[model samples]
Target: MDESFVDGVQGKPGSGLIGNRKFVISKKNLAAQNERGGEENIATGWHAIEFLLWGQDLSETGPGDRSFEDFVDGKAPNADRRRQYLTVVTELLVDDLAGLVKAWAPATKGNYRARFEQGGKESVRKILVGLGSLSRGELAGERLEVALNSQDQEDEHSCFSDNTHRDAVNNAKGIENVWLGRYVRADGSTLQGASLRELVAAKDAALAERGTRQIAASVAAAEAIQAPFDREIVGAKDAPGRQRIQKTIASLTQQSKDLVAAANAVGITKLTLVQP
Candidate 1:
């Protein structure tokens, strides 16, 4: 018998039994035998196991020294075992594209789940052959959308509820955008750090002052209209005209109150109006 063949079965002394029943060596096997005890590193945790059985890893952990067994035994703390397992699982799934589709048809309910789903078994087989045992996250995301739609069928009523719509709107509104403009000096040069929060606050305060000035302008406009009518009615000394002035005063008061209410709704308070 060839020495290499004999040595392959009965590994060197401390390495453990080479040709024992527990140890099987064949030309087809690429991985080392565990019984021979040369590191026993077959990558056997969830990822390795998934790869061995399914021939793929679902998680995209990438090529590394860690094994599937390391994940199961908790020896590989740094490795992302979940990704590895998924990578292998996806790969294996791609192998029997037709079989997998038929098996998953009940869950998919005839709707296309992904690009692969559209192509059916042939597409899946091509993917498996091309990518081998790698799980593509982008493809997985697309696949998940199909799964989610199928799942939504089971809870149809809650799927399009008012609360869900409201939550989505509220979440969208939570995003805030703020712009910072450069502060310029008297000579037209920009100042460093001049657009900080304190400066912005001061600028906002100035805007509030301008808003109050608008209120003053509104009061002036109202008074201008009332003054001419008051003068006409006073000159005529008519009771009916005096009643009209009183109604006008009330209307102006209500308008002022409404303006205040509008300001409060937008979080704009503490206005200081300059008296004429």
Candidate 2:
């Protein structure tokens, strides 16, 4: 989900979705929404949970740090409501993830995974589409460039947690992982197998190698970005932090182009992103 947009009820009019800071912080608001079969606008997933825990990022140097007392009765306003809201939102998030798991379950008949497994060239096309879309439009453009151009601290992705640096690193690595068909398990083990990299190599070795190098460069560039991302986006246009972000953006843009070239080398004619 987009982090900046206001997801639910606005306290006042004329407040833009991305600029609205008046989130419904009252727990009672959750109850009312739940009874109404849930709110269509309540931002769900990562940012929603982060807001419930951290409140807001009022500072440029650090993330929101809501006190634990905020969740305790007699310590803060609407403590009970906050706890209930967290519980409900977390449960809903889990349920939604479960649905995704079912859709991609390897053995499920007529599920997305089943179709994907048999899709062959079309499936490869889908993978390329995903990598290019995420690298180019989603990360480099929408997420990074948008915030940098606006120079608004609140415009940074994961602003509430100041985790946008990590977001950039992990997202770039994720694209690399898909390309290499490699995963480093939590137990410090590595899984390597035949992948898009190998397939592309068989068709066009130089293109495959170029894609690998570009993806690795992007990951390295992303890792160089400093944390407290809100701080990073607010300085002079040529500031060190902003330059680091710009380099990552440039690398991801190049990586996305490499993905398209890789796709073409493998006989896929067109690559397209999922419609927003």
Residue-wise C-alpha lDDT for candidate 2, range 134-226, written one tens digit per residue: 998888987789899998876777877888899989999999999999999999899997799999999999999999999999999999999
Off by over 4 Å in 2: 1-41, 274-276
TM-score of 1: 0.17
Per-model clash counts, in order, read 22, 1
Give the clash total for candidate 1.
22
TM-score (all chains, Cα) for each model: 0.17, 0.85
Window of ten residues with lowest summed lDDT in model 1? 171-180
The true-versus-predicted C-alpha distance at residue 214 of model 1, in Å, is: 17
Q: Which stretches of candidate 1 lie over 4 Å from their true place?
A: 1-231, 235-238, 274-276
List model 1 lDDT by residue over 1-276, tens digit each: 011221111243112122233443332232333223333233222323322332221222221122455335354332233344344435543554766666566456554444445784354234222221111121112211222233322111112111222222222111100012234467988655322123323546554344344334333333333212212133332454344433333333333343343334334453332111
